[model samples]
Target chain A: MKVLAPIAAHEELEMLAAAGAEELYCGIVPREWLERYTGAVWLNRRSPKGGSLDSYAELKRLVDDAHKLHLPVFITLNSPYYTAEQIPLVLELAHKLSDEIGVDALIVTDINLLMRLSQEKLACELHVSSVAAVLNTEAIRFLLNFGPSRIILPRSVTLAEIATITRDVGQQVEIEVFMLNDGCAFEEGFCSTTHHHTVGAFCTSLSEMDTQFEWAGKSFTTRRQNWLRRNLTDYREWVWYVNGNGCGVTPKGLPYGPCGLCAVPDLQRMGVASLKIVGREASPFKKLASVKMVRDIVNRTRAGVPKLHVIERAKQLRESPEHCAAGFMCYYKVDESA
Target chain B: MEWSLHIGGAHELASELWLSRFVEADRSQLTQPWSELAGRLLVTEFGDIRFTHCAFGNEFCEHLIPSVSALQTALTAAQQQQLSFTLLTPYVSNEGIAALRPLFERLAGNGGGEVVFNDWGVLNLLRRDFPTLIPIQGRLLNKSLRDPRVTPMYATAPAPSSALNVLQRSNLDCESYAALLTGLGVQTVETDNLPQGNDLSFAQYGLRIATYAPFGFISTSRICMAAGLHYRKADKFQPGAPCRHECQTHLLEYSYTNSPFGNRDQKFFLKGNSYFYAHTESMLHALFAQIRAGQIARLTWQPRLPMTVAH
Candidate 1:
């Protein structure tokens, strides 16, 4: 199985390669305010609502650089609900990426667009975004019917569930298991902390819109900045739930528990095609070290090369005493005309 | 709310039968036999009245003319000293909205509380063509806005009035039994039956069902539309081994009950009880009678139609 790590800068990519990342998926958003709050005020400027995929020169450079080390690149054009107008722009961008950038695959969720791509033979492979909510092996099969090479499973899936799916559907398509720094259940794929609560806009339709939502009295607008502020310079959680105790269906970042640092061995046993790390705000140094730790463990574990020693290495590598659990990006279904 | 009497005739009450408590249970407590004493429901607990089309899948632009006529007739039939009708339009193309201009012309000189608007394009057009049509963002808009965290059923109303920009272009739809029935702060909610979370399918859940249609259908709409009454037991496949997939042509209509068992049983079923939707609608209409009974500043519709009784 190949392992992919999402990186922001070339520095991050270099660190990922040193860490043994199979592939690198990156985004085009400023990272500072992100450190502050995933608050509505902070928007991905390059891909505003219905925004086009960022140009390939920089992304291509990253991909080209990764290729030197034999690492592949899967470009993310995943967001939700492109208006009827954005469709042409998206198809055009898909063409450029497939024909020009030579990306390994384009991770996507939009059905109408996917259906269109099913007809045209494109260059890059298509993997359903986890936000498209492929939960079971049956779902993977249905998605495969559309002819995708891979299916990004939902973040909320348990290791047992992953294994079951891989057992049933693994031969049909590659399964991508998340490795590190997924904030919310899945699609909220960023590093989450206790100090500042970061809520991912799983619902991508309105996420890009410079709009606010009015529901049940308190309105949460995407564009309007929230006045409340807090600081979380310190991070600690084992004070809450016992290991394997509250691991079932708890949202990340509660007062009592450390967020889920999950079952990598089980994922390996399940035999996923790729081990992906969902990186959002991890410092390049931490990301590098994290990648190195995970890659070594995966290589050792998969090859039957010193398994316990790799576990020991993982324990020491996962500083902050917090384990790193990986999962898929959350996708929502708000296609313009689903 | 528990009531003393059952009311309404067959055709009208068929939709209300799902509210078995009000229609069926209330029958035991009534002094009058559904005809005479039922009339008191109008004077007691009803407010502004609304008449809507029998909601089915995808009413196209072409259906608007007949829909308008149906709207008028249903409105006239529903008229009483207190009852005023709300013309419910289906989601149609902008051309569908344009067609309403003539209908609006007929209703203009004689105006009342606005015609509920759901389509954004229609909302834009109606503001110019028939300002009186009173554009309200229907729950359909909210359905399209698939924010799982924010359900129309949760808080019971659209956020607060402050969250809304309520210019003339805005009237809200607080659908009856909407996710949050009382949460949405719409001027009024059109209800057939209280929304049961069962068989609820939306664009989001659609993907979940692609692999298992019966479960998908159940998660979407509880009642089967075609059979009119019955629940599906298992998720059905599109074709292949079962039934030769013959039902694929009219999948939406017949697919609701397409069982994986194939023809093993004379009555294999899955996903929804469309008849339940029917019974629930009538049940809701009677409940609407109780809900609409109190308002002072609106036209109300509560008189039972003699022609449509549940047989």
Candidate 2:
């Protein structure tokens, strides 16, 4: 398996590549788009503030530099869907990235955009974004008609489901799974809530809401309501911790969000092609640490380490035994019976 | 415009008392049953409408997919009521697809009914093998902005018009998208009555529009909170964990206090794995107007909050 890390700036290229990142992906929103759409109408799913490169020149430099290190860079245009008027501008940007900037592939989500790409036969490859929410093998087979070389599975899918999907279609298309950082409470593709910095994410704001419970058209007792409220609060907190405690990092310079290092053996055995490290908007240090940690685990797995020892080694790197014990930060559910 | 009553499972169809009331109720006086189900008076104007179709099946969770026997019960009820049957489906894993295939086969053999698909794979399945079944794009596939927080900001915020347009617009406005759906054998698309309002001008694309009322989904999750309401803390948030259908019995209402989006009294309802907001009276009035103008061809009414079977 290869390590696909997020790249934002040209300067972070050397550090990430040195940290064992074989592949790189980033989002770029042009100045012209910002002047018009003003970041609210995101060209990509990410906020344009720090999540994306703001100029084509910067993207060109980053792509060129990463290619020199034998690393292929992918660009994200993975908003859930694009309107008719926005399609022309998006296609223009896709063309420039594929033709001029020499990007390796375009990570896309919109079905219409994928159809357009397929129709135009763009030079670069098309990797279906997780935002497209291709959860089933039938969905993968359906998407195969569009000719995407890779499919990034969503965070909502379980390890068993991933194994099934890869087993069914892994031979036809490369399968990528989220291995580290930034987890979503809901399936990102099905989530239609806006993610602007102004309004924040819908799920994050849910934790602050007061609750009332009704069953069969009657209110629950105060004690029961309060108990359920606590449960709901705990659930929200768990979701927050799994989503990286608002993209938090630990004292040891390791990321504090969702981790799937223990599942590396399962993913590798299932013929998974790549392990994606999310967070294009993360700080440079967090990116490097994430890449290094995943690289070490992959190396251990490749060296024929026992699966149990590899799982323990991965848990030790987090420096948070309580979270690992609770399985609060697990991206893929670990089978205890195993 | 036509009307359709959407229920979640076979139990709702088995209620002879409810079925009789729904069939014989006067259009102008039909709001009482819906209001009683919602715990509040939801729709005020029915405008001499009558339900001509009955839609069953869950759109958010694959676990809630109706079994083969349930599908038979729903089809029998629809036939007895002289209404067309529409089968609803959710985004599924390979297992979900497998579970739905038998139901699809039943529907197909029953002489073809309308099937609403929320996932592209399901649509592909229908087009490929179950070609006899009619495909309607489910509301979940209608990716438009339905966030309640941002809906209120559309009037007060000083954001650019283009930014707001992005919020108010949806794939329906795209000709290519409409063409794609039409190419895939879809003639009607389902959408929510968004609080920010909708532009149904896309009806010119020769595609009919079906809008759901009273409740619009804000978001859905595979990490079902309702399913784990009784589980231990360590196992509470596990994705794809088995459940006892706790969502069918409990309904949660969330109200924001000291909300940063101002004092709009934002309230959301959590049912099953989805969060929804009740449509305002003004939004319903606009929807009625749209129906009158012939822009909306169908109104799918959700009497209950989650559109699930009564407990």
Candidate 3:
């Protein structure tokens, strides 16, 4: 399995590759683009601190370094959608990444951009980012019109569902799965709220506070309102409802690293081309650790480790044994007991 | 200019109000001139295409998605009622797309209804498999960043020019973007009554525009607090966790405490699986002027109704 890791700079390239990153991806924000939109309207999903390369020259250097290591670099242009005004600049960046930088691929979600890239006939392969929300074969078939070479599946699907998709469309293009890090409680493409808060994404913070629920009628309000108010302390349960697991740095929380390492054997058997580890904004230390962990799993599974032994190893890698105990932290649901 | 009424389903807007039955089904029935309305937008399931407050995790939600039979029956009934139909769809997974293929094909077979697609996949499917179905861009895909935090800023005197520009610029405001969508077989687009307001200049771009009045969707999430209420534990607060359709049972109001500009005091309505806010009468009237001037060709009247959760 190709371990795709997030890249922020040339400095992290060698370490990432040495840590077993076979492929790399990052976002670029040129000075002109930043001056216009600022960090508020991110050209890509990551916030300003979300690991965007400052200049095209920096990106080109990163690409060159990855090429020396014989690794391909994919650029993320995968914001949910871009405005028409933003498209020309975005396309310019796409062409530069393809021809000038010699990047292997451009990860995109906007169909307008996808159609433009196809029409423009850029050099690099187009990768449908999970932001496009390609959840089904029909969605895949839809993306096929633009001719993407790889599709990074969203973190939301279960292993069974992933198996079904790979079986049906796996042969058509390279299928990628979220092998490690950053799982959203909600679907990425459909989420419209700005994730630009300095603390964390506002969507992820829904469970942290209480919001008053009001409506038009009296009896309706009285019954529903009083019941909800009475359960103010229990509202923490509701927070968990919004966040799939509670928000914490611990393994038990929903915002915690939702790892799919346990499901690697099945994913490989199903012909998944790559396992993605999200964390472009994370520290190099964290990125290196993630890469090492997934790389180790890839090495073991490829060397034909027994399922039982691999399962035991994966349990140790998790935040806590109980993190996967309920099968919630498993990026892809595995049938094995924790 | 045209005016159409949008309802969740026949359950909400029956042929006649079922006064004897229950309030949920009876209270908000369309009558009078609306009965003869030329177009009716029936949401079979809140389009998975949009971010809804309730999510069943992945694209396909057993609890949230409506069945093919239900959609077909609704379409046929709409036809009998002499109301033109526009099928609204959500962002979905391959399974959800596969599930809806028959329905898309059926729509094609049934004289090709207008399909309002929030997901590009649905649009692509229409182009490939069901070409005859007229495709309109749904409001969800009309992604103009509407952060409620900025509403108070717009209300303030000397509002920041940059924020104003961002607010005023609709995704369709760029002529080329509208042209691109037009090239993709979408001639019509739907929009929310945004507080920052819309620059309907896209009308000059040769696209027909529609807007939902008095209930602009600020944003939505699959991590629906409403769905979470039914879950006994945080671990159980996931998709396919045996929901009892708590969204239909109740509505929640959310307010932010640390909001800048006292924006937290603004109450956003959480109904079913989505967050919505009512537009002011003045806002509606101003938009009505645009409709009269033909900038916006259609106005979709969405009457507030009790949550009617469906299959």
lDDT of 2 by residue, A1-338 (tens): 89999989998999999899999999998889889988667888888898799888888989888888999999998887788778899898889999999999999998888888888778899999999999988888888988999999998788999988888899999999999998898988888787767667778877766777765455558887777777787888887886697677777778899999999988888899999999999999999999999999999999999888889999998888877877678888766446
Ranking by lDDT: 2, 3, 1
Number of the predicted model whose TM-score against the real structure is largest: 2
In candidate 2, the residue pairs with backbone N, CA or C atoms under 3 Å apart (3 or more residues apart, or in different chains) clash, namely A244-A257
Per-model B-chain TM-score: 0.37, 0.88, 0.78
Worst 10 residues of 2 chain B by lDDT: B23-32
State in Å the error of residue A279, model 2.
0.9
lDDT of each: 0.38, 0.82, 0.66
Candidate of highest DockQ: 2
Runs in model 1 deviating more than 4 A are: A28-55, A185-262, A305-312, A320-338, B1-311
Q: Tell me each candidate's TM-score.
A: 0.44, 0.94, 0.84
**Residue-level error in angstroms, candidate 2, position A234:** 2.2
Poorest stretch of ten by lDDT in candidate 1 chain A: A227-236
Q: Write model 1 residue lDDT over A1-338, tens digit each, in one string.
A: 77677666655666677768777775543243233223222122122212222345676787788888888777665543233334465677678777887777877765445665676789778887764545455445545656888888655455556777788878888898655544331112111101112222321111122221111112335432221100000000111111111222213221111222234555666788876665434456545655665676776677774444555555455443332221111111111221
| Model 1 Cα lDDT, one tens digit per residue, B65-147 | 33345445434444431233344443442234455556566556445444544343344455555666544333333222222
Per residue, candidate 3 scores C-alpha lDDT tens digits across B69-154 of 66767676666556667666666656556766777877788787888777776788888878898888887777676655554355
CAPRI class of candidate 2 = medium
- lDDT, residue A81, candidate 1: 28
Per-residue C-alpha lDDT of model 2 across residues B220-293, encoded as one tens digit per residue: 98888877778888878777778888777667777866367674477777888888887776676777788768
